[model samples]
Target: MVISFLSALLILAGLVFFLGAGVGILRFPDFFSRMHAAGKGDTLSTLLIIAGFALYQMRDLGDSEASVSAVLVALKMLVIIAFLYIASATSTSALAEAGWEDGNDPVIAPKHENRLAGPPESRTAAADLNRNSTHDSQP
Candidate 1:
């Protein structure tokens, strides 16, 4: 019961991170910001959710065939977690690099500045302007 409850709690926390990532991707002004959200949130959420399931799988650990199978499944989950950690980071970096090479500029603002605190043109529009300049400069 305790294991199940803990697993559920972890899964829910993971879901919250997933929600945060979704909102960040939608609300962020540019490519690099969205990638930051997706990369960090997606990686952490996946890890948390998988860890929960792995914990749940250990609920049956004992001297029996079912226990052995549970252990195997937990190990498999661990492998998946490891693979995702590497793959997600690699893919995020690759995509970000591709966007940078394609002349997508990030939305840079002052520290502790609200995104909406600035004039509208100073927000994403500025990023667009920068991107255009970079694009024009490219041969």
Candidate 2:
């Protein structure tokens, strides 16, 4: 009974994190922020949920007939959780780097610009401005 309650608690906590991730993905203004929410929340929630499952599986371990298989199942869940932690972090970083390299800029409020003017121009436009300024300076 105690094991079941603890398992439920962990699973519920994981679900709450998952809900937060969903809201962040929907509400964050930029890709990186959304990815941050997804990666962090996904890794932590997966770990918690799987850990709860592993703990719950062990509840049957006291039974001689089910001990070995229950132990093995719990071990497998643990391994999965470990792999997910590494993979989620690595993938999130890689994706964020790729987006940056591809010129996806974060939304920064311009000091003098009116709020209703919408976001600044695209990265290509900025790059063009730089090139034009460099050419003007050279000659």
Candidate 3:
């Protein structure tokens, strides 16, 4: 009874974390921040959900559930966690990349994706770099 109760509570908490992450993704003002919340929160939520499911299944399987099928199911769950970890990290990296396509990208970031704090470097360095690049391109 106690284990089942804990499992239910854990499942509910995991769902809350997942939903909160979705809201954070939609509401965040910048790509990096959105990706940050989405990646961390969703990963944690997924882990929690996986753990809860594993516990629930274990309860059902008990000594009987410890068969090969149960082992396979648990192993599959572990694989899923690993895959999500990699995918979330890759997607976040892609979001934070600055090397935009020359012609394919829009002229500017959407207001939602814009950051209030400018990049680490000031406008002077950026201008210098921009000018140097343009000068070099004038072949």
Candidate 4:
């Protein structure tokens, strides 16, 4: 009974994490931010869910005929969890790095007329034209 309850809680927690990740991915401003949401959320949830399943599988550990298969399955789940635990962060970092290398800028704030006219360095690429013009005019 206790094992089942704990497993259910873990599964629910994983589902909740996934839900939050979905919302974050949809609401976040840019690629890196969305990837952050996806990477952290999905990885944790997957670990929790798999761990819960593995624990639940322990219920059959005492059955002589099924014990070997049950242990094997639980080990497989653990291996998967370990693999994902390593892969998720690296993959997210890789994607974010790729985006950075490709020159994808993060959205710092909402687009508006005032923001457009704000500090020069904070301005978007479109405003870069005005900066270059002064240099071009000198030569």
Candidate 5:
């Protein structure tokens, strides 16, 4: 019963991460901003959720039936964390390279800053196109 409750709590926390990611994707003004929100928020949130579940199952860790499953789940979580961190970092860098700015404002790639995105004109054009399609798809 206690384990079940903990499991529920952990899953709920994880779901919050998922919800956060969704909101970030929708609410963030740009691809770069969205990526930042999702990469950090979702990863930590899922880690917390998985840790909670691991704790919940600690009592059964030594059992012949559940030990293998628990270890496998834990290993899977580790792998997920590793891959996600790399992917998120690389993808965010790539997005910057592809000209994603943070916020809805026009940004000038200052000579001092290591800006990766393209010129304001191109980015604005893409933004306009995105806005058009998004608005059209709305109910």
Candidate 6:
């Protein structure tokens, strides 16, 4: 009972983080901010969810008879969590760096008219201008 409760809690927490990441991706003003939210939230949430699963797998563990299969499965989940922890961060960093190198600039807040509050057309125009500028500079 206790193990199940804890597992549920962890999974729920992970879900909450995932929701936050989705919101960040939609609401954040710039690429870097979105990426930051995605990378951090995804890594942490994934670790939490996997850990919860591992713990739930071993819920039957007791003093007398131990399940070898359960232990092995938990260990495998742990290994996956570890790999994801490293790989997710590395990949996010690489993507962000590539965007930077490709001339993606962070949105700076100005005192006057907020770019974020502007219309979709204006935003697309700005993006188009940036894309055109990058192309013009190349070759």
- Candidate 4 lDDT over 102-128, as tens digits, reads 867666666533442355455555457
lDDT agreement of model 2 with the native: 0.84
- Which pairs clash in the backbone of model 2? none
Report the poorest 10 consecutive residues by lDDT, candidate 3: 99-108
Query: What would the per-residue lDDT of candidate 3 be over residues 21-59, giving only the tens digit for each residue?
Result: 999999987555676778888888988888777666656
| lDDT, residue 94, candidate 4 | 91
Every candidate's lDDT: 0.89, 0.84, 0.71, 0.83, 0.69, 0.87
TM-score of each: 0.77, 0.79, 0.64, 0.75, 0.53, 0.77
Clashing pairs for model 3 are: 61-65
Pairs in clash, predicted candidate 4: none
- Report the Cα lDDT for candidate 6: 0.87
Worst 10 residues of 5 by lDDT: 100-109
In model 6, the number of clashes is: 0
Tens-digit lDDT string for candidate 5 (1-92): 67778877888888888888889978987566776777777776767676676666564766697687877886776677677767867876
Cα lDDT over the full model 5 = 0.69
Best candidate, TM-score: 2
Off by over 4 Å in 4: 109-139
| Model 6 spans with C-alpha error above 4 angstroms | 63-66, 111-139
lDDT of model 4, residue 73? 91
Sort the candidates on lDDT, descending order: 1, 6, 2, 4, 3, 5
Candidate 3 matches the true fold with a TM-score of 0.64
